[model samples]
Target chain A: MAEECYTELEQAIQVLVANFYKYVSKHSLVRNKISKSSFRKMLQKELNHMLTDTGNRKAADKLIQNLDANHDGRISFDEYWTLIDCPYMVYPATDLCK
Target chain B: MAEECYTELEQAIQVLVANFYKYVSKHSLVRNKISKSSFRKMLQKELNHMLTDTGNRKAADKLIQNLDANHDGRISFDEYWTLIDCPYMVYPATDLCK
Candidate 1:
């Protein structure tokens, strides 16, 4: 699809899905899953601004452990969606819509 | 936070969260929830490109019915996340990262 045809919301969703694939290793046994190390790197690089503990290895590891819901030791798209809960952290002070 | 400080991924996430609040009624009895009518308008305006049935009222209603997990006639943030599953529809042809 043409980039110009996408709405801002559609483009945002594409950015999210594309970011996940960008960090997914091609050599992994799973086709579209992100390995633990890559997921950590993603947190540090892509989400450092939003997540306070991205710079803390231990905290990041704990978060990864929690997100690995299927015990597959990797993050799937569904697993990654769980991080959306952190929007509270992103807008801590005010209700933007209010 | 300054707009320039956000990574592309962070900005994308903010867009998703903000879009939800934009449709949410300020006077809702339960704060932050989006009513059925507002949610439908959101689908048509924000997600028309990604969701083929946005123009079809029956289809959109069915989709909202499925998304309203609690059957409360309104959508919560968690319910909104379910729509992310449609990333498959957004990138139908090619492996975008490959």
Candidate 2:
């Protein structure tokens, strides 16, 4: 049951990524909605926000960290855009070290 | 190029569906955000809204119509929920006739 639950969460992440990616391609103007570098930065900031635990931090944080490929301490919106097209599963803790 | 374009669109649809499905399972309360029946009804109404072209009709319409599985001229919310688990490709026009 737990496995099934996790799967649902994973599916949701993929779906949102795919949806955004789809629109990004069709409407190049969507890029104007936010910059690539800015996106990554925002995502990382949101991740820290999650750690705070004052708000709906876990979900909010996971939403952002779930996107950050490298924990190199920062992400740019441009790098964030590329992930939208890829089929991404969560990175492992060890994977983050690289 | 056109084919690539279509693929992006298909991906987007799947992503959005998957994301919603994921949230629905994890946070059952998200269901309360609206009723299953109301969701379907709203979707169909949105479809009709798209046909009007007054606002951002097509995107708005496609968003809803894409969700409505049966055109019985109506969709109830419960039926809408099940598809979140299934990977749905668009129904063919002939299939719609049924």
Candidate 3:
């Protein structure tokens, strides 16, 4: 793909989508939804910096509550995007890091 | 500011948030919302590759229609996030570019 033609925002969005697949691909037997354990690993490994409490299982559970809209205890792409968008929309990244 | 500790997903979220402020900063006197014209410019320059129809005024306006939830013709951060999350959640970036 000729990625060079894509602007920063477009490329950034691609990075986000690609990151989801990256984790899903690492786990076998799952393509559409991330299992509960896999989602935990994703939060700890990929979102540790943004979510300082990712190591806390209880906090992680609370975070997943809203994302798992169907209450299936699994995360679909839509659910994952919802998780990302909520904080991304509310807080500045710099402040989040601090 | 110790960015090295941040994971790829964390940084990607930062990029998305920073992109919003980048445009907002460029246009003075407005910190909370992007005017219709500024939003158009953002779509044209930042999403041209992702949204091929960005060059068309009607298409841009139509895209903004849903984002402007209050019907005020301006995009607040929540509305902007809504606009981005819709397609980002629905389509794969590679497919969207195609």
Candidate 4:
């Protein structure tokens, strides 16, 4: 289908899906999941503008602890979605997406 | 901050967040939640190209039923997020965003 056929919402979803794979593809060892270290790097490199304290390893680890539903030390697709959603879900008024 | 400062990932998240309010703000009585009726309208209008059978009321109702996590018959923000994410998370290879 042509790109113009997609609505804004659909395009937005595409960006998110593509982004996950973009990061995941960076490391072969992790396969479908993002290891703890890779997740940290993703945060530092990709999410620094929206998220604070990406420079602090301790803060980043704490974030993973909160979003790691299975406590497996790996960030799955679901976990990654939830992590990116924290700001929007918690404070819709002060959301970064404005 | 300048829009250019945001990374692609951050911009994508913003689009998702902005889209939520774009729909939610349409109905005053629903508050933070998207009523069942409004949710159906959102699907038919915004997701028809990506989701099949959007014209079918039954399909739309079934979708809300699955995404209604609290069983409140209303689509909350998180519920909406999960619903939009189903296509991507379930079939990453055939994701609509691509």
The C-alpha stretches of model 2 lying farther than 4 A from their native spots are: A1-36, A50-98, B1-36, B41-64, B68-98
Residue A75 lDDT in candidate 3: 86
| RMSD in Å for all candidates | 5.2, 16.2, 3.9, 4.2
The CAPRI quality class of candidate 3 comes to medium
Q: Highest lDDT: which candidate?
A: 1
Candidate 4 residue lDDT tens string, A17-79: 777776773666767788778788988788777776677788778888888899988888888
Question: Which candidate would rank higher by lDDT, 1 or 3?
Answer: 1
Candidate with the larger lDDT of 1 and 2: 1
In terms of TM-score, how similar is model 3 to the real structure?
Answer: 0.81
Chain B TM for prediction 3: 0.80
Q: Could you give candidate 2's per-residue lDDT for residues B1-98 as a string of tens digits?
A: 13243233333434444443432333354442343444444334332221223134354344346555664423333334433322321211111111
Instruction: Give model 2's docking category.
Output: incorrect
Model 3, A87: alpha-carbon shift in Å?
3.3
Clashing pairs in 4: A14-B97
Report per-candidate DockQ: 0.63, 0.06, 0.58, 0.61
Number of the candidate with higher TM-score, 1 or 3: 1
lDDT of 4 at A56: 77
lDDT of 2 at A46: 29
TM-score per candidate, chains pooled: 0.88, 0.22, 0.81, 0.84
- Give per-residue lDDT, candidate 4, residue B87: 59
